[model samples]
Target: MADLIPPTGRVHWVGVGRATGSGLGLVCDEAATVLWGRTVARAEARLEELGLAGGAEPRALAPGALARELVPGDVVVAMLPAAGHPALAEVALAGEAHLVCPGYAAPGLSPHARRAAERGSVLLTEVGLAPGVDHLFAHDLVGAARAALGDRPAVAHFASHHGSGKDRPDAFRHHFDRAPHEALTALLTPARVIAEGLPRRVARPWEEVRRLTVGGETFEAHPAGDSLPFVTTYGLPATWRLESFARGTLRPSGWNAAWKPVLAELAEADAAGVAALAERLAAVHPAHDADRDRVVMSVRLGVHTDDGTDWAGEWSLDTVGDARESATARLVSVPLACAVLEVAAGRVPPGLHQATDDPEAVRRWLTFLTARGIVATFRGDGAV
Candidate 1:
């Protein structure tokens, strides 16, 4: 490990998108923060909307503008699209600053991570919602299962789902930078899962949709991304025989039926046609102020030994947005905010980190999240 650069407590938060919620307030309360938006005025407006006016400096996001202001040991919280992260990583590296993002670690960031490790700076990713909170839940469950089952043969299943609220206009919810159609198109990519002790690639994930129940509510679930790597990431013992493993998205029941037409159109449409379709869909289903969102995430693991000892456990989070903040924004940003605070305090080591697998850190983060009103419950059956 490289020597860590002592934090200066100055933070540059880029992007004021939907995921930017009260979490910014958490960062501002702890650091000398600057909120960056497409324009200074837009950033200011968001601060005011977040009731954070005068809480932090506001700036326009001009090319190279943020890099010019960074100093060694400062933190850069990237709330932008995944494509924009590598460039920001470069900026952070050039300034010898630490970087944090709530999205998955892009392959482009690996080189930056190596560089950051050498420079004594940190590059943290996947600390939000599905990738973030879900990871914590998975790690906790795995730790428990390992303690209880040892090297016993076991079967495991994991799923995290975000469903629509009662007031949502349509099945599709636009939470990230991508347009609805574009986001849907990206889902066409194949998903990899370990099933029946064999790795398999799913070319059409939506077609593999299965019904799942979390907290007594049924949802339509399907694989989201490649899950093979997480077997090691989650610290599952290789000696244990595996039955099934997957990481996927969850939607309201009947979601497949509701999205059939749109999926058909997306399957056939070219780029321009997809853009047009997105526009039509947006116009028809414009998100309203009254619109509320809900998120439901569940991670479960089950193990059995030849002696007939059975152990099973599950961790779940189900939250609905209020008039003040959307559930998506709260769940995503709050955990990210906690991560930022952790980095600022020099708790996270330099190099690439994907939400800590350390048991103590996981416990602290869950406590912080629960204190802030985002809570995940756990249930266990049989064994230690």
Candidate 2:
């Protein structure tokens, strides 16, 4: 990717959603202009309301025009649904431009990865908060811990929890900040984790719920999905006594309790029944355009060593946004926009990849985040 980049580039935003809306705004701040594409007029109108539509060239992404709107050396921020990523990857490759998205690349992206390789374009996925910021923080923590431990035999545990909600409390304990469908899917899907030194897949969502308080706000953190893969991604040695590692999502105080009946209904309901439940939830907890919201995330790595020496390293982020902006939007969009600029400037290495945990890149990225109002603190042996 470093070898492929040109001295400058243009940005094209595909899809218009919560994070993508903010992403377009940030991209516009950096670049002179941006191309905004969406399938629906209502979505485009929303962007216009957010003040993102004016400076951007809005276009309708009708059918196959995704590939036709681009040229070489352009950077495409794909905020399309997960199912649409594979085709978008192909479009990016066909246009010979770098691709950046907040989600993981689908299986259909493999062939396009090769094509991107030949064209010197890159596919960057999983570049959002959890998979993005948390990954970087985990890498830094593990690396720092390893350096401090030296030759000591150690045991390690890692965890990351994140969620967002309105500032004013609500019965549901959460709002549809992003696409309601995505939240619905997260609520219904089973989570995977490493438990008792083995991979444990939970058949239900919101299991093993626990309380978490950060920056004076409290939330319910639920077991999300497998985090063992990050053990290697963070460069923890297999020889270390790795006891447990997991990543989970967080919600406001009464989120799990409020959604319990909804989950129960979804499990036993038919297709139509599921849709009805989803509609009810969305109607009741619609995202408020004028409400302030908060985003909190914590990443901790604990190491147990010989001779009873024990300690842990921790990093956390807590922030709130007002009616005109949001913590969720800024955290998700800024990093992605910065990444696209990095790729354009020849900072990212070539080939297909997800969110990178490279220490240098992470430090730079974190610095950028801090500049953009998302401050994170890190502690080694003591509090920051």
The Cα local distance difference test for each model comes to 0.84, 0.74
lDDT of 2 by residue, 267-304 (tens): 78766776777788778778766888888888888887
Backbone clash tally (model 1):
0
TM-score of each: 0.93, 0.88
- Lowest lDDT 10-residue stretch of candidate 1: 169-178
What is candidate 1's local distance difference test score? 0.84
Q: How many residue pairs clash in each candidate?
A: 0, 3
Tens-place lDDT per residue, model 1, 22-133, is 9999999999999999999999999998999999999999988998899999999999988999999999989999999998885868778778898899999999987899
Say which candidate scores most in TM-score. Answer: 1
Residue 123 shift from truth in candidate 2, angstroms: 1.0
Q: Which RMSD values do the candidates have, in order?
A: 2.4, 2.9
